[model samples]
Target chain A: MDEQETRKAVHDRIDQLDVPQDLVAAAIETGIDQASGKQVKPRRRRHLGRWILTAAAAVLLGVGGLAAVNPSVSRALSNVAWLTNFYLHHDDHFNSFHVNGIAKSMDQKVTSNGVTVHLVEAYYNGRTIGYTGEVTGLTKAIDPEQDWVPLDLDDTPAKNLTSSTSNFEPTKSGFRFHATFLVDKGEVPESVLLPIRISNVNGVVGRWNFNINLTQSQQKHAIQQKPYDLDLPGGEIIPVSMTTFASGAEFTFRTTTDGRYGFIGISAIKTAEEDQLIDGTDGYYASLGITHLPLKEPLVQGKTYHVVYQYQMKTDGSPEADIVGADIERDIVLWPAEQ
Target chain B: MELTLKEITWAQQAVAGDREALGQLLKSRGDYLYRTAYLYVGNQADALDVIQEATTQAVKTVAQLRDPNQFFTWFTRILIRQAQVLYRRRQKETTMAVPPEQVAPMIDATAHLDLLAALQVLGADYRQALQLFYYQDMSISEISQLLDVPEGTVKTRLRRGRSALHDQLGGNYYG
Candidate 1:
C-alpha cells in the first residue's frame, strides 16, 4: 500500500467507529441552551409574593433583633459563599454560616485503590451547598487548578451545577480539598447522594459517593422586590428581578427573544453614593443570577437601586461593540421592607 | 464532513450570539469533532467527554473569536486542547494504577490492517500529525494553524510520522 492507500485505511477505520447519536443530540442541546442563556428546564412557577412574605416573617422572628445590635445577621445573609471555600478561611465570611447554627457536619469516607476521601462538613442554604474534606494515601499531589473534581448527583434533580475548589494543600499523607457546589433553588432533596468524582487524579479517576442529609433552615433574612423591566439598545425589554438572602442579593435578567444580543452581566452597580465596578470576583452570570452582589448595606425594602450593565453580541462572530460606552442603566425598586 | 456555505453562514451567526446558528454549527461539525476526539482518546466515552467539554469552552469563549470564517479551525483547536488535557490525565492514571499489559486494548482495527496497530506505537505528536494528514485530509498549513506551530514543523512531523509508520509496518505496508 502507498501513502494514498494508507490514508484510505486510516479514514476507513475512523469512519467505522460508532459515534452515538444520543450523545451528539445531548451535546448540541446543552451548547444551544448555554449559548442562548436558556434554562436547562423551565423553572416551575412559585408564588413569589407568598414565599417572600413567609421568608421575611421567618427572618423577622429569627434575627430581626440581633440584626439591629450586631448587623451580623444582615451581613451574614449578604456574604454568600458562591464558590466552595471561597470565603472559608475569611473569618468574617465563614463565621456567618456558623453564627446561625444551621450548617451540618458529617464524617463520611470512601476508600478505593489506595486512596481515601474524608468529607468533613457541609452547609446548604436553599441555593448553594458547600463541603470540605481531605484525601489521603494518594501518591500524587492533587492540584485543583489542573484537576477537575466534578460533583455527580445520583438520583437527584440538581441542575446548573457549578463548583469551585480552594485551599488545596499537601498534607503529611495526602491533600486537603475544599469545594462548593451550587444548584438552582429547590433542586436538591432533603437528602442527596452526591458522588464527587475526581475525573483526573494524576490520570487515575476515582469517585467518592457520600449520602448527605440536609436540614432546611429558612433563610434568616431575605427581601424580595418586584421585577423591573429594563430596555436595551435594540428596543428589547428584559425583566430583571432581585432577591436578597443572608448570603447576598441574586439579580436575574430574563433572556430576550432576539438572540442577537443577550444580557452578559452587570458592569457596574450604582448605589446613591458610589459606583462599584463588577470585577468577576464580585459575581457570576448565567440566565439565572445575572449577578449575586454581596451587599454593603442591607437592602431596605422600597428603596430603589440603580444598576449599570454591559451587553454584548451573543456569539463571538458578532461585530465588536464599544462595551465600555454601551452601559444600560435601570432603576430597580426593592419590595416593601415590611409586608 | 465538509462545511457547506450555509454552515459557514451559521458559524458567523453563532459567533454573533445567535443560539440557533450556534446549534446548527455544532450539529454540522459534530461528526468531525467526534472523530478527531476519538483519534486522541481512543475510546467512545472519553471522546464524548472531550467533545462536550470543547463545546462548552467554545460557547463560553466564542465572543473572543475574531474571524467567523475560521470557526471550524478555532473550534477544532479547542477540541484538540480538551483532548490533550484528557489524554494527559488518563495517561497519568494508567501509568500509576494499571500495569502495561493489563491496560485496555485500543479499538480493534480490521483484520489485515497492521498499519493501524503500528500507528498506535508512534509517539502522540507523530500519530496526531499523521491522523490529521491522512484521516482528516487536512493541509499542512491548516494542521500548523490548528496546532499553533509553523508550517515547516507540520511538514517535518508528517514526513517523520510516515517514515516511522513505514519502518514499523515494513516499507510495503503503505503500498
Candidate 2:
C-alpha cells in the first residue's frame, strides 16, 4: 500500500479500537483533582547510591571495591537480588560487558481496587530503556514549580532542560546516559569475590559475595548471607505511619555483588521490609577508620586471596541481626584497569 | 439529592468521599486509557490491567499535576507504561516453565515477521516514540513533553524505531 493508503488503514483501525468499560470507570474515578502544592527540587536521579553501596562492600570485604580489577569473575558478582539476573558476557577482547536477559515483571496489580507499578529498565541489549517496569511506579515526575536537573543518564550530570531544545543528539533524551550506562561496567578479572553488607529492621542481617571466575569446585565456595537483608542495597526512605504483626521494621541496606551499577530498591511489598530497605539508608556509610590492606598490585584476577574486615554491628545477634566479619576467599583473576 | 446533582455533583462530592464522583471519573476516562493501552499491548486482559494501574498511579501522583488539561497526556504516558509492564509480565508467565528453547526468542533475525508482527518488533521505547510522532501526529516538541524526553532524543528514537519497523515489515518502514 502507498503511504497515504497505509496511513488511512492505520487511522481507520485506530478509530475502531474499543475502550473497555471497566477501564473507563477506573480512570474516571481519578476525578480532576490535580497535585499543585509542594515543589520538590529534582536533582539528577540518584547515582552515588551505587558508589556508597560499593564503599559499604569495601568496608565489608576489606579490599574495598577492587572486585572490578579482576576480569574473570566479573560475571559471577553481577548477580542481583531476587530475580538473579544480568550475567555479563564478554568476547575475547574486553570492550563491553554484553548483558542479555528476558526482562521480567512482578505482575502485582488489581482493578481500580489495587495498583501495581512497573519499573523502567534503562537499557536492554543496548537499547534506550523506556518508562516501563516497576521503577517508573517508584518515581513521581516533579511538579512544574520544582527545578529539575536535566536528566543525565550517564553517571554524571550537566543539565539538559533549557529554554528551547534541538533534535538528534545523545543528550536529547533529556537523559545524559542510558539508564544502564548510568552504571558503567567494570572490566572482567580472573577471579573476584565481593562480600556485600545489608541491614534491616531485624538489624544488619548479613553479607554475601559473588565469586566470579570460580573453578568447578570453587562455585560452592560463594558466600551466602541468610535472611536476605532486603535493605542491603540502600534505597529511598519514606517514614511509615503504620506497622503490622508480620511487618515491624524498616529493613534496608546496600549491595556490591552486582558490581558498580547494581543498585536495587524495594518499592512496596506485602511487608514494608523491602520498601524500607530501598528508600532508607541513603546517608549510611561505616566510617572507614581502620587501615585497609595495601600490599600487591590490587586484587587482580587469577590471584586467589582472602579478604578480612574487623567491623561492628547493631545489637541484634539473631541470624538476621547486625554483625560484621572478615572477607576471606582465594585465587582471583585480574581484569585490567582502564587507564 | 437533585437531578443535576448526579451529573456535576462529582466536582465536589468526589473530594468528600463520594464514591459516585469516583465512579463517574472512572466511567469517563477509563475507556480512553484502555484504548491507548490496547494500541501498545494488543491484548485485552493486559490492556485492562494496565488501565487499572494507570488509574491508581494517577491517583497517587496526579496531585503533582499542574492543570487538568494535561491529564490525557499524563495518563497516556502512564497507560503506555502499564501496557509495557503487562507485556513484560505476560512474557514472563508464559515462559515460567518453558525450557530455554521454548522461550520467546529475542529479535535476532528480523526477516521472518510480517507488518503487524513488525509492530511488535520494536521495543517499547522505539515503538511508542514512533506512534507518538506519526500516528498521534504529535510534533517533536509535543512528543518530548509526552515522553519526558529531550527533543533530540525523541528524533533518535523515532529514527531507530522506523528502521526496526522497516526491517520487520520487509523493508517497509513508516515513521
Candidate 3:
C-alpha cells in the first residue's frame, strides 16, 4: 500500500470506531458547567452530627471527656468501640465486611505536641480503602464557625484518589474520625503502605505522620456475569453489566450506539417479597453515570430481586433539551438456573 | 478534520465567555477528539475520560486562547497530554491473570488492522507525530506548534515513525 492507501486505511479504521452520542452530551454538559462556573462540588458531611457522643466517644477521649463515665468500661470498649461507632453513624457497608472478619485490626498511634491520633482498623476490598480511628488530646476547642482540617493524608500511591471523611464527633479532648479512599483507575496492589500525615488540627499546624499498612482481603465474595443489553428509544442499545460484591452492587453501562446523552440512576433494590435490601435511614443516591450501590446485605442465591432505575435522555446541550425520562424495573436472579 | 469557519466563530465567542457557544463547539468536535484520544489510550473508557476532562479544562481556560482560530490545535494539545497521563498510569498496573484480549489474535492481515497494530507498537512520540500528520491531516509546522517542538524534530519523527510502521506492515508506506 502506498501513502494515499495507508492514509485511507487509517481513516477507515478510525471511522469504524464511534463514541456514543450520550457520552458526548455528558462531556459537553461538563464543559458548559465549567465555563459557567456552575460545577457542582461533592458535599462533605461534617459537624452536622444528629446523634450525640455516647460511650464510644468517651472510649477514645479516655479520662478527659466524660467525668461520670467508668474507666473500666472505657478500656473494655476502646478495643471494638471504633468498629461499632463506624457502623452506627457512618457506613453500613463496613458492617458487612467486618462481620465476615474481612478486616485487619490495627492499633497504630502517633502523638505530637500534646495530641494523639490513633489508626484503629483498616478494611480493603480491592476497590476501596477504609479506616476508622480517633484523634485525642487536641488543644484547640471545637468551633462550628471555623472549618477544621483534623487530618491531611498524603495520597501519593493513587494520584487520582477520591476520599470522603465522616463527621468529626468532638469529644472533650478531640474527636473520633472515619475515612474512605477510592482509586478509580486500575486495581491497587495486594499490599500497600499508605502514608498518612495529620496536620493543621483545628487550624494548628503540626505534623503527625504514620505509614499504615493496608492489605486487600483475600476472602472477598464477588459475582459478575456477561453484559446484558438494554434497548432504549430511537434504536439505542446500552449493555449493562452487574457485579455483586460482599459490600455492594456495581452496575457498569457499556455504550453501544450513537444518538444522545443519557443519565441513569438506581432508585431501589427489593426482593420478590418486597423486602428492601438498602438501609433507608442512610443516604442512598439516585446516582449519575456508572455507580456502585452499597447494600445492607448481599443478595441470596436463587432469589429474585427487582432493580428499579430511572433514565433520562438529552439530545442537545441545553438544559431544556431533555427528550424523555422514565422509570424502569428489571427483575434479576442471582446464580440463575442453567440454560 | 480542519477547523471550519463556523467553528472558528464559535471559538471566538467561547473565548469571549459565551458558554453556550463553547458547549456547541465541543459537541461538534466531540467525535474527532474522541477518536484522537482512543488512538492514544487504546480503549473506549479512558478515551471518554480524556475527552471529558479535556473539555472541562478547555472551557475553564478558553479565555487564555490569544488566537481563537487555533482552538483545535490548543484543545488537541490538552487532550494528548491528558491521554498520555492516563496511558502512563495504566502502564504501571500489573494484573495477576492474563487478560483474554491480550492472548487473542486481535488483528487480521487486513491493511487497516495491520496499520493499527503497527501504530499500537510504535513509540509514543512517533505515534503522536504519525497520528497528527496522517490521521488529522496536519502540517509539520502545525504539529510543531501544537507539540511545542521544532519543525525539524517533527519532520524527523514523522520520517522515523513512517519507516517503523512500514517495516512492521511489510509493504504499507505512510506519506
Candidate 4:
C-alpha cells in the first residue's frame, strides 16, 4: 500500500483506544493536590534552598548514557534493533541518521556484471556501518519494485556531521582517515580507495590493530574533472604525497597540463555482510535497519564526482598508530576540480 | 466578571485551607488529568500511579504558580514528564526480560494474537508516537514540546512508525 494509506490505518487504530473517563478525573485531581502540597513556608532569614535544588537537577541530568545504562528500557525496545542503531537526530532541516565506525580496511572485489558493488561480507572491525546494503543507493530503494521498501531520509547522500545525543558531542575518535571525491564529466575519475592497518607499532602490544586492502573500479563515470579540495566539519585535513608503504600502495597526484596534481588511491574493500543488510527474510525487514537513498537528478554528464574518505587507526586522539610517528595520515582527494 | 470573581473567591478559599473548595477543584479536573496520564503510560495502573505522583508533586508545587490559567498544559506537562521518567528508568533495569504486564493490551479478542504480534513488531518510537498523537489526541506541537524535540522530528517518527505498523499488519494502514 501507499504511504498515506499506511499512516491513516495506524492513526485510526490509535484513535480507537480511548482512555476511560474516570481515569482522567483521577489524574487531574492528583495534579492539583500534588501542586498544593509543595508550597514551602517562606524562611524569613535563610534562603539557600533554590541553589541546592538546581545542583541536584544538574546531577540527575548527568547520569550515564541514557540508553545503555538503562536496562529495562533497553529490553522494552530490544525488538527495535534498526531504530536503536541509527543516529537519532532530534533536530535537523532534513531528518537524517548516520552510520559511524572506523575500519582499518575493507576488502574490494568487483564482478563483471557492469554493476559495480561493494561486497561487505564481514561485520568485523567497523566497515559494518549501513543498516542494509539493499536499502543503500543515495536515493533509490535498492530494488524499486519491491512490495516492501525503505523510508529514505533524502534523495541525496549528505556528508553527515551529527550524532545521536545532543550533549554526547562528536569527537575525533574511532576514524582512521577519510577521502572525498566529487564526480563530473569529460575525464573519468578513478575509484578512490585506501587500505589501513590497526596494529600499533610504537613498542605497543596487547590491542590488535587492523589491516585493510582496497581496490579501484575500472568503470569510468567522468569525461573531464579537476582537483577538488574538501573541507570537513570535524578533524584535520592533510595533503597526500608520493610515498611508498609496505604493501606497495603509493598515493600520488595525476598532474595535468595546468600543473595541478590530483590524487588516486583505495578507501575500502568488503568481503562479508554487515550486522544488518537487506537479505530476503520474513521478519528481517522489520528488524533490519537499512539506509535508503535515491539520486533525484541523474549523474551530471561528464561531471560526476565522489568524495572517498581516508581514515587512520587511532580514534579520539588515541595514539595507537605508529606510522612515521604521525597520527595515521587522514587525507581527502576530489577526482576532478572541474566538470 | 461574575465568574472571574467567583473563581478568585474560590482560589482564595482553597489557598486559605478550605478542604471543601480544594475537593471541588480536585474533583473537577481529576478525570481529565487521569486520561492524559493513561495516554502516556499506556497502562491503567501506571496511569494511576502517574496521576497520584503528579498530584502529590503538583500540590506541593502549584501554590508557587503565578498564573493558574495555565493549569491544564502545566499539569499535563508534569504528568507526561513523570511517565517519561518512569519509562527511562524502566529501560535501564529491564534490559534482559520484559514481562507481558508491560505490553499494550490486545485491541480485539479474536485477533488478540495477531494484534499483539503486530504491536510487538511495531518499533517503540512508532507505537509510542502513534499512541500519543492518535490515542491521546495531543496536538503535534504538544508532542514535540513534551518530547523536547522539533515538531518535524515528531512527524517523521509518526510517518516511519505507521509505515512499519502497516507492514506488520499485512495490509495498507487504512485497513
Q: How is the predicted docking of candidate 2 categorized under the CAPRI scheme?
A: incorrect
Pairwise DockQ winner, candidates 1 and 4? 1
- Measured against the true two-chain complex, the DockQ scores of the candidates, in the order shown, are 0.15, 0.10, 0.16, 0.12
Q: Lowest-lDDT window of 10 residues in candidate 2 chain A?
A: A208-217
Give each candidate's fraction of reference contacts reproduced: 0.34, 0.19, 0.38, 0.32
TM-score, every prediction: 0.40, 0.32, 0.42, 0.31
Residues B47-148, candidate 2, lDDT per residue (tens digit)?
A: 544665665666666546564444456656776777777777655544223211111111221232244445655677887887776566667898898777
Give candidate 3's error at residue A249 in angstroms: 4.7
Tens digit of per-residue lDDT, candidate 1, span A1-339: 776887777778667655555556566676556555766542221110100011211111111111112324433332334323433444333444444544555566766456666666666654556666676777765444433332222212234444422334455566555544455333334433233433333334543444454544333333443334556544243434444443344444444435556344444455687644222221233432333433323355576767665555555435464322256777765334555
What's model 3's lDDT at A189? 54
- Give residue A210's error in model 1 in angstroms: 24
lDDT scores of the candidates, listed in order: 0.55, 0.35, 0.59, 0.34
What class would a CAPRI assessor give candidate 1's docking?
A: incorrect
Give me the runs in candidate 1 sitting further than 4 Å from their true place.
A32-339, B63-67, B95-118, B167-175
Best model number under TM-score:
3
**Distance from true location, Cα of B43 in model 2, Å:** 1.3
Give the clash count for model 1.
Answer: 23
Give candidate 3 misplaced runs (Cα > 4 Å).
Answer: A1-103, A125-128, A140-160, A183-193, A218-231, A234-257, A277-304, A315-320, A330-339, B1-175
